[model samples]
Target chain A: MPNTLILSIDAMGGDHGPSVVIPAVDIAARQLGDVRFLLHGDQAQIEAELAKAPAARAASEIRHADKAIAMDEKPAQAMRRGKGSSVWNAVEAVKDGQAAAAVSAGNTGALMAISMLVLRMAEGIKRPAIVASWPTMNGISAVLDVGANVESDAEQLVEFAIMGAAFHHAVHGSTKPTVGLLNVGSEEQKGHEEVREAHALLRANSFDFDYRGFVEGNDIAKGTVDVIVTDGFTGNVALKTAEGLARFFGNELRATFKSGPLAMLGAVFASGALGAMRKRMDPGAVNGGPLLGLNGIVVKSHGGADAPGYAAAIRVAADLARSDFTAEIDRNIRRLGAVVSESAASPAEGAAE
Target chain B: MPNTLILSIDAMGGDHGPSVVIPAVDIAARQLGDVRFLLHGDQAQIEAELAKAPAARAASEIRHADKAIAMDEKPAQAMRRGKGSSVWNAVEAVKDGQAAAAVSAGNTGALMAISMLVLRMAEGIKRPAIVASWPTMNGISAVLDVGANVESDAEQLVEFAIMGAAFHHAVHGSTKPTVGLLNVGSEEQKGHEEVREAHALLRANSFDFDYRGFVEGNDIAKGTVDVIVTDGFTGNVALKTAEGLARFFGNELRATFKSGPLAMLGAVFASGALGAMRKRMDPGAVNGGPLLGLNGIVVKSHGGADAPGYAAAIRVAADLARSDFTAEIDRNIRRLGAVVSESAASPAEGAAE
Candidate 1:
């Protein structure tokens, strides 16, 4: 742990728990060498699963946690009685400097609550944002706040731009990442007042990342911008809407192939092309969402994510830990003085600074 | 025109005014079998295009308008100085009872303004809503207030519920169209307060539509409910986001097939299946968004939609005109008392009643 990059894993979280997490850790450890796993959960269950992966077993140490937060637990309840839980301990590892980052597949609200309590917000962040890698025609774009805050103002949206760009930079190694404010339309007359305000402010001032003014919902999948900034409400809806549509598209294509004898024959002939298309668009192929704006890195894998999907999330955590992500965020926040200065009086802000 | 169903056409509206409208009316006349078109625009341009379609010329009467509303014109400015414009005349045809419904592929703001001014809102409708058919997994569902009103209160959302259900019923012939308030989550406490309030109201009070409780953005394309109720801002963003994703999916699939020789060869074999999928999912295949709550039906085609798409919108107008859509809306609005009672004093309310 002293020399190796370490990630804390909440082994008790997710649908399959240790069954999926252990294998994912094994995959992550293999792909990213010199990484140690601090597994938090039932020791017996984890040990059993770890035995199957000799490399992971050799590189990992299990830390027993008494409770595992329920998938349906309320955030408030998780905060009140989440001490020593698997997710709590996992997040705590990052705070204690035992791990560089934390990965979890627990309830989103619960994980966010515990992470905020343990790791806290970075200096000057009004609220932490949940960022996801949206697969676009031109590779992937970073979209935030996917559901960290319910609503946002001009200042908050401005903050999202900086954080989103930083996240994109950390993960994709793209400097001067183009950021756009996600609105209904690029027209000045369109969108809610806050969106218009953010658009104007972002356009008027220069930031560390390249601000690309206002972009419509249509521009999101066009890869029109590297980082899409929006209020949590719109961002959350856009993300889910895209997911739903993508699934619908996939389902419709599959249904079309199975509609009749002629279609089925065509399916056999074009099986390779169809299979390639599916593989390219598979959600599992890109499952992790990084909870950004926190003092330490936290990667949230989908609860239903499979071994490869969970491994993807673990890799995201590992990548963020290896980069200067936290320091970069701190510098960007400092550069965006207005956003932080507004909420500068909080104790958390001082501690983060 | 005595025995035929008549549709008013705004020939000077879309990207390619007469080129799109004349051809679309021609296609629609062939599809519907017994339909008359009242073409309103520059007489010279209308006459030239009508010559291309003998069927359209036989079924249409060209009415010359002095002005054509620019696609980028503001709604208020259009209303203030757009008298005798093609769009204005189209709405006037509906007001004069010469056409049962009007179809336009113009600036949305301009169309809505002209329609509202000439045709007016239905009795007891607080504000007219833009309702569109959303392609979903199970089937097509109607989603409403898709940029009609930027913000909505609980009462307005309830009204949208009524209008959406009525629109669905009129178009799809479903007796009790299921209605759901669009929210960030399925939970009771997941969206704007107005949304939660609407959820409670809809759940508590019975209506013509089956009131399902809260649904998330993902549910919009899942066909979870027949009608999705939301403010224009959220609904507009969700609709465009889905469109962006659908386009992205199609683009990605095409690119994947073109990536290599085996894939391209497979694509050739699966061409039939792939074509069927594209045709089924093509936005043009179902290109008509009815502007609900107006006293007379107004169908809006996508401005950039081509022949088949514009024809689809005209067909939608024809279908609505054939049905008692306006009456159904009136009855539903009357049933949802809270919505109308708020803005019940408007002149359009009186005229419709």
Candidate 2:
């Protein structure tokens, strides 16, 4: 059936590596059928782990990659030297059309750098942006440019908005996702000169997505905006800060729940409720983030992700592949390109420009 | 006794205005001895609210102010037109030496703009920075430049480091607080050119404070560094994200604890534990943030603060006034200024420069 969704996963990536990735893959494959995984890493370690699970052994294939990219290595240097590294090899599988998508829980910088170099940008993408979704009070909100292209111009940010909107629609099933430009204030004249200009550009462009105007930092979790866009620097800081606070709150809740007999009894009785709360708050459910505006699929799982987290990433890759999201983005990009070209020739005419 | 630790509070500010501020002042007066509040606002409204509180009737003084600064108004325009506004009058009290410090839960932009215009920058200070603190897993970390200066140069960021360090030491009672430059990576060479240059400048200026090198987003909750410094844009986004996540988590917990009968039982037993958790996670505890490097003391409380939150702001202002934090900062600025001047004159002789 159109050659079962094949994912090339970096086995030696993340904090726990094969120990976590293997179990996660096994769980995902067991739950979701018609999925094949090409696990790339050292053969011996992977085989040793795979030997423990018959289901995993049957569902996955091993591809050897002798090298691993160090977390500290510079992205450019790592890409230059790591010809056979797990990250590079996994990306290569996508490039060679052997795999529909590539997943990595390794060094984010290396992954982004390799994806850009190997898969290259989609037809009209000036720069690919990293987009992630955060658990909000209502549901979830997607934020883009979280460490992709650290220094982006107005045009790059506009591209990020387009990609981010498409991602929300593809992944979250959002129809006409509201796009917002993140700024210090919601007022039109509030942010830096770049933000003001980007605001004008987003407004003038008559894209399929719903442009919701500017959004503030506090509005992120309020679920007021569907897709929030910003430069990589601000987006990165915002994402990490949300992550830090989530972890902090989790720790505090756990500590408080085990403080005394009353708390322990409460936790026991509220097990069902607590389980529901845990599921809602767990970062694992929202573990994978797609690198948008890329020609091929690349999903970066959390670096500290466990087996369950990795499993989620694999499912994400499969979903994107099944929906032909890349084809959709390509068509949209070509349409946008025509509009851009015409605008340049005409100087100022058409709402699309 | 010591002028009763007079605090000039903008009673006409914030979402709830004197309704919240008056009750907070009343509570603080009854709770903390020898604390006098000079409340500036519409005299009639202030008195009407003061009459509601038994303690406020005797403890607070109502100072008449004819206008109020709107939250969305331009900072410079607000300063020029709002001379008779409560926020302006509050700062005027500090300028006239009637109050030790000025506290406002009003428009942060307006507060900083007026504070800079009226109080001016400290002798060696090129720009004043807004510093905020939030509860982290490892206690608290102070983040500076939370929307003080939108665009920052290398020198401004370095000065932020020094100012943030002094703030942590004076307010948080830390001895030789460690200062870190907030970046995307912990590596020395990572981040923008400005961040890299700032890192070197911080390391070179031995006379300023203890420079703990670079820190990333995840390090914020780790409390590895006491004072984290960055530009206003990054810092503002980070602070707001953290605050938003905390609220999101708290709401999730509450919803889960009220799901069913079992959840209700758990909530009843865990009431004490839940209370403890709430206390720790309460935004009020970290209500007010000082606008550092200004000649006079100015504290900006959250705009959404309620009575208890306003009380926390008042207490913070009073404590800062008693500590003579401004004088400490001024003295350090002189030392830093001398070092900067000497290094400039010698060109290559200074050890750190």
Candidate 1 residue runs with Cα over 4 Å from true position: A1-3, A260-262, A282-285, A339-353, B1-4, B283-285, B338-353
Interface RMSD of each: 7.8, 5.4
Model 1: per-residue lDDT, tens digit, A1-353?
46689999999899989999999988888999889899999999999998898878988999999899999998889999999999999999999988999999999999998999888888888888888788777778898988887778877888888888888887877878999887666766667777776776666556778988878777877889999998787788778877776677778877877877766665666667666666665433477788887888899999988888899899888888888777777777676676445544322111000
Compare the candidates by lDDT and give the number of the best one. 1
On residues B1-353, what C-alpha lDDT tens digit does candidate 1 reach at each position? 47689889999888999998888888888899888889999999999998899989999999999999998988889999989998899989999999889998889988998889888887877888898788777688898888888778887899899888888887877888998888778877676667766776676556888898888788887889999988887788777777777777778777876877766665666667777677666433578998888888899998988988899888888878887777777776676675445544322111000
lDDT, candidate 2, B1-353, per-residue tens: 55588889999889989899899989888987887889999999998898899797787778899999987777878878988899999999999998889999988888888888888888788988988886667777788888776668777887888778777776787877788888876777567777877776666656436788888787787677888999888887777776666666667778887888888888889988887786676433588898888777888888988898888877777767877466666666666666556555322221110
TM-scores, all models, native as reference = 0.92, 0.89
lDDT of 2 at B211: 86
TM-score (C-alpha) between model 2 and the true structure: 0.89
